[model samples]
Target: MTTHSATLREEIEEMIAVGELKPGQHLDETELAARFGVSRTPVRETLIQLASMGLVVIRPRRGAIVAELGPQQLVEMFEVMSELEATCGRLAARRMTREEQQSLLAAHQACLDARDAQEPDVYYYKNELFHEAIYAGSHNQFLIEQTRNLYRRLRPYRRLQLRVRDRLHNSYHEHDGVVQAIVSGDGELAAHLLREHVMIQGQRFSDLMASLPQLRQGAA
Candidate 1:
């Protein structure tokens, strides 16, 4: 994506993540252009990019609408995604070069900076880098591609997760554990920690679900 389109896409994704643009809501390109003070071209390009990420659906005659996934579907996807991440962590623990390990540590430190700053949005982007570092550390091109595809599709939800009260701090702590396990070359422990880190369940699941209703209400 072009820089303009990328920026527009992130902005739109943020709106969707916070429920400012609820699922199934139409995304009119012209209106979006006006809203962002840009031309229709970039807005159109962003919609196409968003469509590729499964964040929006484009219709034949109609325009684009935010894509919707049922709760069960979301859960199933997360379950599979967690396993993919766990596999990456397992392989990375055994495979990461010294340089790659340092890179991962740098990414983790960047996340810590953002978290300490108490800037969730900044932390969110840094969090992406931290995860991407692990994905690359796996050194498996096909595995990286597969994991990234799903990660992009679920990006907004992952961002939304941070909004679930103290989740940002909790996530940072989890990342710390994951980094330690991988750096220590503990494949089994890394895999287990990564799986637990990514899995959305128990109180986390309840907190996320509870936040959604409030977001929807605010949007309404």
Candidate 2:
């Protein structure tokens, strides 16, 4: 994708994630094009791609609306993410290179620094890089591709969870455990810890959703 399209896609995704564009809300192509200061052609193409990604729904006459998130989908996504991260950890324990291990440690340290500075966005992105380092270290291209797809699908929800108080600190600790297990070449321990770490996010999301009246009302 061209830079314009990629930026448009990211903007739209961010808007939806932040609730600027709510689920089931229609998206106006002309408005998006004007807001983005780009032509409608790229916007239209981006919408189609977003629709394919299940971020939006495109109807013949009604244009696009944000996709709804239900409990079932959330559970399914967590299950998939748990499996993917576990597999990545398992492979990484056996296959990780010295440079990859160093990179993972560096990324984790960066995340810790970002957390100390109270920069959630920077910490979140660095956390992503930390996980991506493990994924790349797995040495399994097929697993990497599948995990990337699942990670993208869950990005919005994951980003939202970053705002939960002290989540950054807790996540850093979890990443430390994962790195320790991997560095020690304990594949089973690495896999178990990774799955637990990822699944805990799901539990947190569930608890957060339960406590949010607006979210409950929306689901109702």
Question: In candidate 2, how many Å is residue 106 off?
Answer: 1.7
Indicate the residue-level lDDT of 35 in model 1.
Answer: 89
Give the winner by TM-score.
1
Off by over 4 Å in 1: 213-220
lDDT of 2 by residue, 25-132 (tens): 988999999988999989998898788777889998889889986767877787889989999999999999999999998998898899899887788889899999
Please list the C-alpha lDDT of all candidates, in the order they appear: 0.89, 0.83
Name the 10 consecutive residues with the lowest summed lDDT in model 2: 211-220
- For residue 164, give model 2's deviation from the true position in Å: 0.7
lDDT of 1 by residue, 112-132 (tens): 999889888789899999999
Alpha carbon deviation, residue 50, candidate 2 (Å): 2.1
Q: After superposition, how far is residue 204 of candidate 1 from its true place, in Å?
A: 0.8
Q: How many Å off is the CA of 52 in candidate 2?
A: 3.6
Worst 10 residues of 1 by lDDT: 211-220
